[model samples]
Target: MEKAAEFYTLEKGILALKDQIDALAETDDLDKKDRIAALRSEIEKEWARIVPQLTTVNIVQIARHPKRPYTLDYIAFLFQDFMEMHGDRRFADDPAIVAGLAFYKGRTVAVIGHQKGRTTRARIDRNFGQANPEGYRKALRVMLEAEKFGFPVITLIDTPGAYPGIGAEERGQAEAIAFNLKTISILKTPIINVVIGEGGSGGGLGIGFGDQTLMLEHSFYSVISPEGCAAILWKDQNAFEQAAENLGIRAATLLGFGIVDKIIPEPPGGAHIDPEQTFKNVDKHLYQALKKFEGKPVDELLDERYKKIRKLGVFEER
Candidate 1:
């Protein structure tokens, strides 16, 4: 069984036990009640053992899990009065990227994210979250609007990569990503980036530059996807597991490297298992992050952002 499926099975068993306990709640049997307590303890111990031992491949699988909440899912849960902004103005609207203004905790903010879609038709419509140049442009347009209106920008990243189709290239994909990187780095507004799922390549970075960078516990952020790296180095896509191990792209790894400022803890067995709890965890962190920048000077924010960017790959010789 796949790692994610293993976790799913385990969680399913726990749910079944809980259901049994609920069903027995009206019973007068003391033995049944004691059994319920034992079951709960076992569940807790299982989670404690499993979560810390999750492998890189397991984490990658969880990040790509179909049931994991997407950008729009989060917007619906965390924001209010969301008015979706569409199109790049220069080109057509790209379904792969979603951008807009919304009320987050009663504060107006711009929200941008990759939408991988849920149903098969929806996934096709979103191109599996592989954005194009126009998508990046649309995101940039929203960021600019956020800057003008002095609204903080929050981006949720989840993409395998930018679309690699010939049409995407013909439309100046690389240039579009580069422009976003350049513009967002110096944008005179607070920006928060969260790697909610697969943070892959320049696609993730296109709207990923921000004052605060965060990743979900099971999410992975990488310059290249494991499959891509395996194909390049070993000429075998099946070696992706090995590639994942070597990439050091897990939230804990990235946090240690200072690549991600914070790691939002996921519920046991990953976000797919308990999405409500996952949303609450993300909300808590996001609330704190927004508060951190409130009333701060724009010049100070820019200076700190510049320093953060400059420090990314800097290291001293051993």
Candidate 2:
């Protein structure tokens, strides 16, 4: 069974007990109530022991958990009065990249993110959130519009990587991604980026630069996915476990490297288990971050942003 994985064993066992408790609790017997209470305690103990010892691969699995919330899910919970914008005028709209204007705590902001659909059909339609050149172009257009109106930009990054399709390359995928990096770096408005899920490659970077870069506790951000890394380096796709360890993609690792500005705590058992609490935690931090940049001059913001970027990967000679 899939639950045979070391980390899943405990979680699956807890969930199974919970299911039994739920069924038994529906009865009128007082013994059943006692049994349910005992099961709950056991679940708590199992969770406490298992979560801390989770391997990087286990965290990666949680990050990609099918039930875990996605970009659209966060947008729905975080923003109000969302009005989705579509298309790169030069080409057809790309469903993988969702861009628009929305009200966030009474302020209108431009929002862009890679959107992965839930179902098989929807995933095909969204290209599994692997954006193409036109998607990047559409993102650029919306971001430029946001700059024109002086609205802060908020980007949620969650892509496996940009599409590597033949047509995407023919249409200049590299140029499109490069354009976003160049333009977003110096935009006069404040921007915030949150890596809500897998932050893979240039696809993540295309919308990732911001005044404040935040990451969820269990999320992973890397230049390439572990499987890709394993295949390239070891010629063995099954060596992903080794790749994940060496990649330094965890939020804690990125935080230690000064790559991410802050780490937002997720609910116990990952965000999927308690999305409401996760949403609240994110909202609080995002509001606090926005407030920090409030009233700062655009020139100051730009200068500080440049300084921050320049400081990455710097080390003093010993």
Top lDDT model:
1
- In the range 1-318, model 1's lDDT, one tens digit per residue, is 465685566467656755676677778887987887786676667678777777788888889988999999899999999999999999799999999999998889999999998999999999999999999999999999999999999999999999999989999999999999999989999999999999998999999868999899989999899989999998998898899999999988888877899999987667876688899999999999999986689999999999888888856898
lDDT of each: 0.90, 0.87
Question: What alpha-carbon RMSD in Å does predicted model 2 have with respect to the real structure?
Answer: 3.1
Write down the lDDT that model 2 would get.
0.87
lDDT of 1: 0.90
Over 4 Å off, model 1: 1-42
Residue 287 error for model 2, in Å?
Answer: 0.8
User: What is the lDDT for 145 in model 1?
Assistant: 98
Error of 2 at 141 (Å): 1.1
Candidate 1 versus truth, CA RMSD in Å, comes to 3.1
